[model samples]
Target: MNFRIFKYLIPGMAVILMTGACSGNGANGVNGNAASGSSGPNSQAPAGKEVKISFWHIYNTGPMKELYDKLIDEFEEAHPNIKVDHAGYGIFDLGDKLATALAGGTGPDLAMDGIDGGQLKIKAGTIVNLQPYIERDGVDTNQYFPLLIDIMKQEGNGDLYRLPLETDVRVLFYNKEAFREVGLDPEKPPTTWEELESYSDKLTKWNDKTKLLDRIGFAPNLGNFWYWTLAWTNGVDFFDDQGNPTLDTPENIEAAEWWVKMQNKYGTKAFSAFQSQSGSLGFDPFVGGKVAMEVSTNNLVSEIKANQPDLEYGIAPIPIKKNNATWSAGFSLEIVNNKDQAKADAAWELLKFLTSTEIQKRHHIAGNALVGNRLAATDPEFMKDPDWKTVTDQMQFTRFLETPIEAQGWGGQMWKNVQAAVAGSMTPEQAIKTSQKETEDLIANYKKTS
Candidate 1:
């Protein structure tokens, strides 16, 4: 789980709260007993057969873990015949494990994919398609977030292979104090890129004698591909269906160029020491109060509140370009495709239970994670917070990373060069040409083999 749980909130954020996560065999779920079918209105377990299913997931820490454990209990309770055994795994490394397991014919019945997963992008090809199961169960996909259901369905008339468990979206956050100091209305976050640049210029602060940065205009490189966001906002596609690298498109270049300009025009030699001896990414200057505005995600909310409760932040839709498009990402519950129909059927039931509307609502109300199911996002209590609503609303403008398979084989090598150019080593023209050619060659080889 990429989630971090805090039991306690920052003063008013929660009346009684806890910060650490549940570990060991600890789960703060409902009653200790295993629930049987017909015990509740949502039961899906058939009358017979005690099936065992293994699940490997990423959320073992924080409040999200608590929420996940509870959902597991709920699933097991509803299907008294199936016992779900879950193992915790790291987000970054799970991909390798999953690939090995699937290829070797020994993978968990349920597994969580890496951070970039959307419904249609299950490239590892281990998950069972859920179309037949959903139809048989008469599941009303409309009862959940509509696109989540749509995205989880395969692009070309196939079954739903993944169920969205949760989602996080990026938003524009500006510091009210910084806005006040610069004679701008703190309530009005800039609504466009042109306004953002003009406003950012005004927000930059400097010292006379030292000529050091007192505060920055806006933080760039929050250790994320926020550049992708800028590229996205400016309308850059990583590739088209024909597998051509489009990052060199005029809009993408415009976006990346603006970022380069921001770095040169804004502060002094920043501590390029972000990559330290320990190999940890640089400290987040955003949290340290050096940044006045940023494109950020809900994933950082806990840390921000912990460090600076009175930081006076306002969230807005990310500023737009030709039109609006926000990059959204999150975790999903996927069932491994198996030749053993009995085991897969057992596991699919578990996934459906965990991602059901009732359980998803519990996750949202837990105050730790947001529900990815569309129906849960509309829960009246869920949207009470205007900020969360902003994050969820971006779902309206979401873009899934629809990278092609041939590109997938060498995307890392390509992105390494991507990082190089974005870091100023190579020109965008060079980066795109090299990466695109590599992908084309990879696809050609794949075709030759076929």
Candidate 2:
């Protein structure tokens, strides 16, 4: 694969200065000690010196936090020479904190970050190029989903800088009870966009006196809803192979128009008022039976179990148009560029241990996450959960939104423009055209500095 470099911006943040450490092993190699002369489960760290690497992640509470602790303890026991100093941060704060720390030369040796943040770090030179380390250790990139691996590569040149740990897939989830209540077959969920709209119309309820929505059949912009995913199902992508914005495509415009029609059908004022009621009451529209169907990620299953255990729900691959497609996002583990050869090697060892099939399997079970490692994700034992199985089965048809190197903060921008269109403030075509120009200017500015 050709690795290409594209420019993009990190929304709500500024480009900070980043520094790369010189490697003793030359441009294409990482600075690290030779591998331990053992194989399989008995791999050992180079004999004498003990190296400690700091690890930071946003999984700070509950089951996920416990799982991280267990994994770190086991890894430390196995590689006695390496000690991990682990810290947890809230997801919202971690990105800014890491940026500030890296800028001041006090960043952790390794971190678990979202793909977008990892990309920003890669561009900033705050993270180490992991290709050399992968080569030196004979790491098998083939063990991962090709699409997952592809996302980690630098835009212009395929230098891998992050290793994905876990990921999630988007699917359409329906309240089976709601379906039955509407006289629709609970077993047969909507398979096409037209069916989705028809079923939604039947399921939706209105208070004749108040003229407000009592229940919504579906909302295009609800949980895990991504416009790009809709476009993808119609064979449209936001960026071309060369990383230029392609939001103005006919398919994309159609997708945008579809959402606007949904808004108009429900009446934007009534829809917004209904959403406000849910928010005020701390109610989940889907779980509270206010929404018949929702486009959501797998985590919604666990959430439903926790908040409304008796709610019967069914998941299906998202409704398709001309093509079958879904969107996915995940967190990746990355080694930071700290100018320390020994620590970099230590971090590499830890990365391998964490991403190993067995460890990945255990982690997935403990934290209830979709494993990024292909073997663990496909393992029969892990795939036993019907909900999880539904998600994993869609992996082949799932793709990440194309965030060009230049459109780093495109997600927020796209959301804003789409919302404007849905609210009738801008036509679908105008919204997309505005997005394309804004994205182009963002790229241009990024190029000027870069």
Candidate 3:
């Protein structure tokens, strides 16, 4: 795979200054780190004083939960005067609380949200820019995985308003025993979409006499809201430069329709036949000897092994259209800008400590997700893992954010529109056109208010 570097955000000279201050002549500090975390408006906390900052995050019990508490304890111990009051919840609840609290000026001083919402928050002016704090005393870009540096920027002001905390990538997980039974090679997972569909056939089997599907080739959810990845791969987009929604583009319609045809052949009824009983977390159509291949998140690897230790599976980037890519989704750390500069600065210190290489590596070991910072992501310890290394390395080619569109809940709406198309209730052509028009209308409504 070609590791191409896309220039989106330019690292400021300020990173050099922060590296010097934090990493310092102590010679062992993050001075070698290059994020420049203190570059934006109100990025730093007050100097040499105890500042209590409240933080809310979507990280709860798991490896992440443990590591997070440990990191905070260590940070508190290190700073002495800075105490972080932390409140943790599930991802969904975090977003809800942030929306409610920020609106009322009663939110935590620091908060972590899914990166997908970061764009929305920054656009709505719910976040504070971190460039000022990092300009002279921030994290350096060189110390981080370079991709992460630009991942935190906002398009309008080119401000670094958020920091990359943890990230995830998609991988193809397949069943090994199923491959053997079908007389196919289990070692080589399909690399191309065509190969995946063809390999899937080899693993699919049915009881001809009974007219029952004995096994399926693949799961039914691949096409769910993956249009962003497909759109990028095909060099098409569902929005214009003005951020207007354009789901009805010819290329988008083509990508959506192609997948719909595949679902139709598989029999929509067959895919959902067991939906009521099976529900969403269908770990394996393969493990149950029903399907052969699956493309799931890196975070699911741990659960997969725990449930089916003996099941054979391989990890690789999800199949693509033109270039190698998949959806990039993860959680991030940001200051909610409570209008108190001291609290915001203390929050920055907390963000710095949480995203530090030491803490990031600890989080990765827990198997919750990859650290959003650069150095830890590319660290030998990360890339060396047989199962997870490939997934982490693939981020070099990953898209940090999807092309922005409009409306508050437009993404979910678009997802449903596309889901209906895949579930066979609508045609791909119908789905895109309907989604595009609805999205345009939503954008128009929001623009008038602003």
Against the true structure, whose lDDT is highest?
2
Question: For candidate 3, lDDT tens digit of each residue in 1-450?
Answer: 111111111112111111111211121111111322333334234557678889888668766677678878988888888888887887556656666666565668888765533444444445666666567575675665555556555432456767778777767777777877877787777777677778777877767875556666765464222555555555566555556666777877877776676556657566566443244446544444455676666776667665666766777667666678766666667776555656766787888778888777777777646677666766785676676677777777777434333354455566678779877688888888888888778767766775
Q: Number of clashing residue pairs in every model? A: 16, 14, 33
Error of 1 at 325 (Å): 1.3
**lDDT of the structure predicted as candidate 1:** 0.61
What is candidate 2's TM-score against the reference? 0.87
Q: Across residues 124-228, which tens digit of lDDT does each residue of candidate 2 receive?
A: 455677766677678898887777887667431477777878888889999999899979999999998899999999999999999999989998877777777
lDDT (C-alpha) at residue 93 in model 2: 73
Please report, in order, the local distance difference test score of every candidate based on alpha carbons. Answer: 0.61, 0.75, 0.62
Clashes of 3: 33
TM, every model: 0.78, 0.87, 0.81
Question: What C-alpha lDDT, on a 0 to 100 scale, does residue 432 get in candidate 3?
Answer: 80
| Candidate 1 TM-score versus the reference | 0.78
Candidate 3, residue 318: lDDT: 71
Best by TM-score: 2
Evaluate residue 317 in candidate 2 and report its C-alpha lDDT on the 0 to 100 scale.
92
Which is superior by lDDT, 1 or 3?
A: 3
